[model samples]
Target: MAAILTSLRNTVIAGFVLSLVLILMFLNWGGTLDYNFCAFLVRWLHVISGVMWIGLLWYFNFVQIPNMPSIPDDQKPAVSKVIAPAALFWFRWGAMSTIVFGIILAWQNGYLLDAYTLGAAEGFSVHKNIAIGIGMWLGTIMWFNVWFVIWPNQKIALGIVDAPADAKPKAGRTAMLFSRVNTMLSVPMLFAMVSAQNIY
Candidate 1:
């Protein structure tokens, strides 16, 4: 247990092993392999990816960005050149995985079009679909910002890509603003998603 806990890869593998044991137990107890079970698994994956993406997003806003100014200028490179890049890699991929799994979950549950259309297929009468649709749209917009806007500007800002020195500040500002935008949207997005599952 100590060895596994000391290594992230091993810890994650152990977690999956535990999940597999749970599934085997369920099957042994007479749970059937079915479409609903498959859909549940997709949703579980979506949630995991979302936690990674949004958790990192919040970490940047709530911790790193705010604390950066206090750090000595000389030591700043440790964060910029090392930590930031590693975190961003996981952040962007987490966003990608979240969106992909979310879309797949929606499709598996047979609400892809209805949710995307905000229940227009049902004349917007289904509150559940409408709620999820709003969350989905918000998530999509956030994902787009992460990939197309934030990542590109961040690359320039972080000096991963070459740009005139003057442009770096501007690029950094742009990325920060969009990241803030996503943070602002995150609360309502989570509300809408949970509402779809529980309230609506």
Candidate 2:
């Protein structure tokens, strides 16, 4: 138990194994679950990944950034060299997984085209798709910022890339600004995602 607990990979595997066992016990077997049930499962995964991504995003914005100045200068390497990189690894991948699973869930639900096109597709009501569409667009923009803007800048800022000494602060600021942009959008994105179910 201690050995498994000490290893993250083992821990995650154990979790999956436990979940599978629970499914076997609690859920009907023998292909009893259908397409909609599978889609619902995918949606659950998407939501889990999204929560990880946005939770990390908020942690960086609300905790790490503001507290950076207060940490002793000599001890700051613990954060920059170790913690930030680790967090960013999970952060970026969480974003990627969230988008991937979200798209898959959308496709399974048969509204992929409609949501992507913001209800421009035939047979989709504007009211139903609009809310989810806005959420999708916001999520896409946030994903873009995470991959293209924030991660690149963070590489320089965190010294993952060979950046000029004078450029580090600039890179850090750029990353921060984009992260803030995502933070601002998160509220509306969450609203749209939730309202889509109840609104129409």
- Leading candidate by TM-score: 1
Candidate 1 — which residues are off by over 4 angstroms? none
Q: How close is candidate 1 to the true structure, as a TM-score?
A: 0.97
Which pairs clash in model 1?
none
Give per-residue CA lDDT, model 2, range 1-200, as digits (tens): 99999999999999889978866765655544677668878988899899889999999999999999999999999999999999999999999999999899888888788998889865556776878888999999999999999999999999999989899999999999999999999999999988988877
Q: What range of 10 consecutive residues in model 1 has the weakest lDDT sum? A: 31-40
Model 1 over residues 1-200: C-alpha lDDT tens digits? 89999999999999999999999999999998798789889999999999999999999999999999999999999999999999999999999999999999999888889999999989999999999999999999999999999999999999999899999999999999999999999999999999999998
TM-score against native, each model: 0.97, 0.91
Model 2 clashing residue pairs (backbone):
none
